[model samples]
Target: MIGYMYILQCSDGSYYTGSTKDLERRLQQHQSGDGANHTKKRQPVTLVYYEKYDRIDTAFYREKQVQGWSRAKKEVLIRGEVDELHRLSECQNDTHWLERYSSAFGCAQASNIIKKERKKDN
Candidate 1:
């Protein structure tokens, strides 16, 4: 099943990141204050970025990676500046970025797809 990693820019200007099998329903939940506790309190968030994955685990892992990012890094993601994200993530051990995500997000196996793709052709 296809799943999505999404970024929401909240009414209060804070950002929230999450993953779900249904992006529309999740967004609606957040808008209606039935989403995550963080977003529920923030109330009325606008979806600003999303990435689709073939597996729910992949999406969930990406969500965790983005959640730990700085606002500027998230903004770069929202703006589609993938190079910037790479630059930011690469500053570490080149693996820490994704490692932290895989460990925290409970989808290490699925996230390997993204890392593999990155190692290919680019």
Candidate 2:
């Protein structure tokens, strides 16, 4: 059966991620405060984004994955900005892999190093 992974904007401006086999019914539950506790308290949700999956498990997995994302990351995803999503997915800390790999190559050569790194693993 087809499943849906969806993101909803709550009344207080928070985002809720969830998966359901019947999107319309699930949405109605959320709207009626009969859904997740988070959404129940922050009712009047609006569907902002969703993805369809062939299996319910896949949709549930996607829901779980997106639930851990930062608000900015979620926003970019909702906006359908794939490039921004990848850029934001990278760690910004000093010990980031990019920094470690680029240390020897220098910042100017980081893109080339990144390309090589992608080729090596993926």
Candidate 3:
């Protein structure tokens, strides 16, 4: 059965992401405040974006992925900015970069050794 991943713009301006096998029924449930707790409290949500998938699992996976995204990344997806999605998905952080660098160069233990050597030198 086909499934859908949808994004709703809530009454309070926040976004909610969800997946359903029956889009119409699920949307009605959200509108009637019988949906998720998050949407129930933020009622009167507007369907901002949706994507169809071949399998329920795929739709559900997409829903979870979208839920973890930043508002700007979600907006990029909602606006159908396909090209920008790749760019938005890239997360640059010092810790992650350092971990990657350390793993690549086998420097995970080198840091401790360098610290010890510096102490000895002092």
Give the TM-scores of the predictions, in the order they appear.
Answer: 0.71, 0.79, 0.74
Best-fitting candidate, measured by TM-score?
A: 2
Best by the lDDT measure: 2
* Model 2 Cα lDDT, one tens digit per residue, 12-114: 9999999999999999999999999999999799999999999999999999999999999999999999999999998865457568767777875876777
Regions more than 4 Å wrong, model 2: 97-122
Q: Whole-model lDDT, candidate 2?
A: 0.92
Candidate 3, position 35, lDDT: 98
Candidate 3 lDDT tens digits, 34-92:
99999999989999999999999999999998999999999999899988999878655
lDDT of 2 at 24: 97
Worst 10 residues of 1 by lDDT: 91-100
Q: Model-by-model lDDT, in order?
A: 0.85, 0.92, 0.88
Model 2 clash pairs are: none
| TM-score of decoy 1 | 0.71
Query: Candidate 1: deviation at residue 120, Å?
Result: 38
Ranking by lDDT: 2, 3, 1
**Two-way TM-score contest, 1 vs 3, winner:** 3
Candidate 1: list runs displaced more than 4 Å: 92-122
